[model samples]
Target: MTTTSHSNRDLRDEIRDYWSDRAATFDNDPGHKISAGAELFAWANLFRRHLGAANGRSLLDLASGTGEIALLCKELGFAVTGLDWAEPMLERARSKAPEVTFLQADAERTMLPDASFDVIVTRHLVWTLIDPKAAFAEWRRLLKPGGKILIVDGDFVSRNWLTRMIERFSGSTSHGMVSRHQDIVARVYFNRGARSEAVASLLLEAGFENLRIDNRLSAIHRAQAHLFSWRKSLLRRSEHRYAISASAPMTTKE
Candidate 1:
């Protein structure tokens, strides 16, 4: 049997409770849902286009709080399992979309069977992870032979038009600093820049192939938020061929 230390379990519970309170306000607030409308739509479209066909596809939505993206996937014709460690968030998600399966589970450690999903997606959950490579590996384990994993997050060095607009509209560097701080302090997520790269690298190390990054430029032009997408490779034999070295840890700050 596997187990987590009591302290660690307590910490996880605390974080989950916090997010539950924040979830309802998350989308309504500007800072919370910056790229939500256009950027998220683009991401969905990108996934649809590359996904080839969505009817009856099995999807794993990691960190699936309140079931926003999972609901969208169900609407788009995919069978989705919404996973999160928070009961409150999962409860809200269930209330909103009872048709979807919402499970309270850890993103890093899942109880699902291996090679079970066609696509695995997580949004803005990179920073909170202590070991993203391990998280990716877990997702990889749950993905089928020809499955794909999509991660949506932001990079520090990669700034789009909306960032510039925010800087201009805010006027003072103080305002920009506030925005930056939000990225860092929000429930322990990694800030932009190499954090996103580190995530992709982790997926690559975990036997994922054909990795693609989409930094939302079109939405940025539309005065929307900046966003990026990381896609995993789909090949049976190729997974072993692409595994990241377990002996040497991958570091983003390094």
Candidate 2:
């Protein structure tokens, strides 16, 4: 398939179309869910531990495809809202968890109220976004003071020749092959490299503070990944460095 060079809007359109096409089969794909493994389980356990407890808080799951992460948060005692652009994905999420709220909305331009959520979680959505810097700014804007944001996604662990062959052979065995392969291409197009420092810098540019990168694999998840957790701080310099222009408002922390 030929991918045209795209501007930001063009990229968003492509992503929206791509997800819309695959929305029905989104969950069944091996790429969507984490499989069982000691490393994955331990990682999830650690992630939960780091999150403290959801306990009656409100969570906004941005780009929540099948509501898996949102449901997890809901199970942890959060009143959860699953938001995504694809209607079919929301439908599937609602079917799986009728009690939770699932809304069709763009991750970059959601119709959600400002400063509404206590926690914002996005799984594998960053790579799908055309303007992640803007998305992160929006995530910061939607969060209450000191609210937490967790982004769980892949990282560049060196791929060996054998790994490549195994991955190629295993492609037919998983749905994630398509989504993830596309993501790798997109990442290379958007960011020159996949490094914690590069991701952290982008977060900082988007006004996220106290950035931390957590890389832990356990038996509970299928993908070995990297997670970035950051807090919004209530401080500012005279001028925002990464803002699009002087007209754009600086994101107020909290």
Tens digit of per-residue lDDT, candidate 2, span 179-219: 65565455433443344555667777877766667654333
The global C-alpha lDDT for each of the candidates, from Candidate 1 onward, is 0.61, 0.63
- Per-model TM values vs. the true structure: 0.68, 0.72
Candidate maximizing TM-score: 2
Which 10 consecutive positions of candidate 1 have the poorest summed lDDT?
Answer: 229-238
Model 1 clashing residue pairs (backbone): 127-189, 127-190, 155-193, 156-192, 156-193, 205-244, 209-233
What TM-score does prediction 2 earn?
A: 0.72
Across 71-172, the per-residue lDDT of candidate 1 in tens digits comes to 878877898999988777788788878999888888988889977787777766665664566777787778777676766555433345655544455434
lDDT of 2: 0.63
